[model samples]
Target: MTPPLLTLEGVELGVGGRRFCENLHWSVSPGECWGVLGPNGAGKSTLLHALAGLRPVEAGTIRLQGTPIETLSRRAVARSVGILFQDQEYPFPATVLETVRAGRYPHRPFWSGESAEDQRLALTALWETGLEGFDARRVESLSGGERRRMEAATLLVQSPRVWLLDEPTNHLDLGHQIALLELLLRKSRGQQGAMILVVHDINLAARFCDRFLFLFGSGESCQGTGEEMLQEALLTRLFRHPMRAAHFGEARCWMPL
Candidate 1:
């Protein structure tokens, strides 16, 4: 069997002196898309940052391709892992194209300027993200949803083996949400990629993810195949609200009662 692309062993996480995740053991393999479902303030974003090596875990280890992530250099980590953060700050001036091109920064040699091929790849990402014409726009002028798509375009151009997305569809309208998820799903399948994204939409998560991780925010968590974890009981307990399992046009869906 192939080794996992990313693995968390006995990981513990917390915020504000409260431990929300305890002994979390999960592995993400190539070509897999895992959804993280949890209520607000459950350390979902915190966990994504930890996986990207941005912050230290309270306990245990996170390994990237069988190597302890802590031991890797920042550039090394950036080359192999990519994160689509929940919030982004653009403090300086740059066009959307320039911002997306920054994804190539990790792959190119020091001081090597962006090449034609890099420009092509960036344009392809922009097209894929529905920002083909918006590339010329200033990053500061785009709306929140447009900014989200811009960030996604950057992540696509980066093309890392692992994707850590926090509420990737945040601020997106219904159509854009579906389009972005499908695009990411295809990318995840075609690029030897593994994805772990935090999502609040149970139906959307059920539709797109093959694996599931539920964080209960009480120092407890669970993981399983979607089939195993999408039970009504699990969904109800996950949100502290009753949920109903229904079939909608050949899809198994869970909705709150």
Candidate 2:
């Protein structure tokens, strides 16, 4: 049998002595999109960090393609896994094109300059993220939505096999949110890659993700696919409030009741 793209075994996570998840076992394979859902303080971002090897797990292990993540060098891991954090800051002045081109660093030899193909790939990524004409603009001058899209473009240029995104839709307008999700879906589907994203919007999660992971706070969690995971009771309990699950056409949505 083929190994999963990513796996967590007997995972435990916490911050400042507050536990988020315990004894967690999860796996993600190619062509799958997963949404990590939880209320505030549920450790969603912490979990993403753990998956990306940016944070240490309190216990247990994370494996990428069957090899323990800790055993792999950082550069080796970067070649296959990419992460997008919730907030990003660029301290130096740079054009959007220069920022996106940085994704090619991992693929190049040490101290090598960007190649024509790298530039082409970066431009393609920018076009895909709806930032084609903004490449020459200063990154600091872009609005929140534009900055988010530029980040997306950088990740696209990286082209990792497993994508870990924390609140990818942050700062995006409704249209841009949908457009970015669609772009990610196309990329994942085309390359048979996997995506695990932390998301707060239930409707958007339902629309894009094939599976859902819900953190109920304090070392409790549940995961499932389809309408089974979208149950009213499950959602209500997960959010600690009344929630109504409804459908419009083919989409499933949740609302506070």
Q: Which candidate is the best by lDDT?
A: 1
- Backbone clash count, each prediction separately: 0, 0
Candidate 2, which segments miss by more than 4 Å at Cα? none
Q: Could you tell me how far off, in angstroms, the CA of residue 2 lies in candidate 2 after the best superposition?
A: 3.8
Q: What tens digits encode model 1's per-residue C-alpha lDDT throughout 157-185?
A: 88899998899999999999989989987
Each candidate's TM vs. the true structure? 0.97, 0.97
lDDT of each residue in 1-257, candidate 2, tens digit only: 55699999999999999999999999999988998999999999999888888888989999999998988888888888888889998899999999999888788888789999999999999998889898899999999999998988988988888988899999999999999989987887687789998998888898888899999897999888846788888889999999997778976678988
Q: Which window of 10 residues has the lowest lDDT sum in candidate 2?
A: 245-254
**Which ten residues in a row are the worst by lDDT in model 1?**
247-256
Candidate 1 Cα outliers beyond 4 Å, as residue runs: none
- Model 2: residue 129 alpha-carbon error in angstroms: 1.2
